[model samples]
Target: MRTSRAGTSHTVLWAGWAALAAGAVLCVIGWYGVSGERFAERQLPYLASCTVPGAALIVAAAVLLAHGRDATAAARVEELYALLVAAEPPREEAEGERPVAGELVAVPGGTLFHRADCPLVAGKAEAGPVDEHGRAGLDPCPVCAPDV
Candidate 1:
């Protein structure tokens, strides 16, 4: 079976919960055993046999539970990523239909103008020369900062 980054087994996770429940029961049993006893020496046996072991089981359960949760989250993220990767590819323009070199660019409704090669305008479909929209008086892009 495909495991997550943490590689924690599902069996371990189930065991953790089982251990936690059993530990709780053991602790309760120990408490009851000690509470009914009249002497301190009588309670010591319950502490040694039940309470101490119960507390140890709880600590082990905590580690197992945390590991299991991390693995579960990692697996979920992997599933989401697989789904994203399987989605349809975006449409592309023919080579002839693409914009030519030296196409001045700016984002629509944006304040700055940039050269076609500007990193800010790169890969943006909406970016085009201001004159195409009859827009004017825009400031130069601070990054590219084209003189034009």
Candidate 2:
């Protein structure tokens, strides 16, 4: 099953409790049975067998918890980026300004603000740059920040 941080912590704690209980049971048995040997000496090998699986479960739980934490952190980072680039306050268009504004987007290079249908260069005061795609660079719109 998938384990989160709390799950891992719980697993580890339960394993510890089991170990304690097992030891205690063995101790009670020893005490009641009259014996001249160390409490665990009689059945140490059999008791030791459970340790391997218990330890493995604890480690797996810890790793899953760490992964969950990392995912959470990445989500927070994306949210902060969105907040950083909120739409500019409404304003009158300057005489020289273009009228294009792209929506905030996440790109491989950086956040882009534009429509996917139109290239970042389209809808600019100046002409779009000519390239293999002939897509224009984003224009500097007075109302919104378009890639120019």
Candidate 3:
């Protein structure tokens, strides 16, 4: 079974947060070694090294989280594109289609209007775009609400 994009995104976010927590702990330990009266003076050099790598880990984690968000957005767009392609009517009916009517897609028995790429419109018959004056009774899809 393939993992969902949302699941992957959450995993990345959690990893980033773990790295940040680890970095904070390392920095605190390093600071304690350098400032505590109980720590020997000679131990300062070794403990100080922890803070540098801890800071680096925090930065790396932030970068990973940012990329994860970008990837999720890209995945959504790709899914939308696929839905649009599948919902398009066969070419024979498109030969005489009006220019304004080709922009949107809807189901035959549904009461909602949707953008051509809306996932809800997938596998539904195309009713073309909503008429500018005939949209009084139809509701916009909550997921991919078309700007009717």
Candidate 4:
């Protein structure tokens, strides 16, 4: 058997993590430089030969640049998903409420309901809604769409 791992957000997350790692390394180098003289005697031969603050600043800049890009990517993804769902038009449920357009399943007493539209089948799921009293209630699965 073979396996392939990919998802809509995987690329974005990879890019983010890669950038984060690079930035972290840069920050470490930069901080080392800014604190050079304080630990000159403990410095590595090659490291002692370089400008600490300069190295540190470069690292810090790399980190910041990567961090900025990562955040931008994440925000863009959210915007896209929002736009997709928004553009699809609203659905009306029999309850006179907007139908939960996500995935649904069976509850135990009736059916476990969840709010996702994934194609893969799933097991009983907890209700994603919260009541005013701060308690969660299991509602009808949208596909099976049982009454509460």
Candidate 5:
């Protein structure tokens, strides 16, 4: 589903690029026509038929390309945010077993243990109370070393 959305964005970007290229070609043709003409009356048909439409296409292509890029960036941000939320442990578990003051804490996969009040673990979503078994392989945090 996400890939499909990304594909649509890519399609829009490609369409915009194609439009830009076509516009440039049309403008070039108009310029060529005007350059070969001797009188202003002879050049008027080329200006009316090609130059004005070409400029409009270029402007529309720019807007389309910008919108496509913005959509792609927004999708990427949402996907990353979802992954971050999923990686976090459930709040209910942390709520049921809150760590007391001076207790050792560490994130699920972290190698270091820290004091409950340590700045490193303060706002971490995955940080939880580390029991004796949990503390076995973990090293004390240098930033806020917990007394064993």
Candidate 6:
């Protein structure tokens, strides 16, 4: 089975959080070793090493988290596009007559309905025809300004 984009995004997000937590813990341990009166001076070098690497890990984790969030957003947009494509009417209907007000075309997943010849409908692979009367909940497309 193929792994879903959402699943991958969640995994990346959680991994980033885990890395951040580990980095924080390491930084704390390093700080305690250097500052605590009970620790010997000889341990300072090792503690400094831990502190530097821990800071790097924290930075890496921040970048990973941001990447995961962007991936999730992109996945959502793709899913919406797929839904819109699935809602399109048959090819014959699309090629034939001009759509009336109640017969306006729209993507089922989208919020707005558009005229058959609307400029926005031109290169969108996911765009399809939907009846305004049947899809009563969809609003008019602001750009095309269909009478529906």
Per-residue alpha-carbon lDDT of model 5 for 1-148, expressed as tens digits? 2856677889999999999998999899999999999999999999999998888889989998998998799778878887888796644445556666678889998999999889887766678888899999999999997898
Of the candidates shown, which would achieve the greatest TM-score relative to the real structure? 1
Sliding window of 10 residues with minimal summed lDDT for model 4: 1-10
Predicted candidate 1 versus true structure: per-residue lDDT over 1-96, tens digit per residue = 364453555767898999999889889999999999999999999999999999988998999888888777878788788779998876655665
* C-alpha root-mean-square deviation, candidate 2: 12.3
lDDT score, candidate 4: 0.47
User: By TM-score, is 5 or 6 better?
Assistant: 5
Query: Candidate 6, which ten residues in sequence have the lowest lDDT sum?
Result: 93-102
Per-model lDDT: 0.78, 0.45, 0.70, 0.47, 0.86, 0.76
Candidate 3 vs. true structure, TM-score: 0.48
> Per-candidate TM vs. native?
0.73, 0.31, 0.48, 0.28, 0.65, 0.54
What's the lDDT for candidate 1?
0.78
- Model 1 poorest 10 in a row by lDDT: 1-10
Tell me the TM-score of model 2: 0.31
TM-score, predicted candidate 6 vs. hidden true structure = 0.54
Pairs in clash, predicted candidate 1: none
Q: Compared with the true structure, what per-residue lDDT tens digits does model 2 show for residues 49-136?
A: 4444445545554565566566556556656666777757545447444432333322333323344224543434333223223233
lDDT of 4 by residue, 1-148 (tens): 1112223345445655665565566556655665664565565543644444345545655665566566667667766776787795444334433224442432334424444342222321332333233223554344644343
Write the candidate numbers in order of decreasing TM-score: 1, 5, 6, 3, 2, 4
Candidate 5 versus truth, CA RMSD in Å, comes to: 6.0
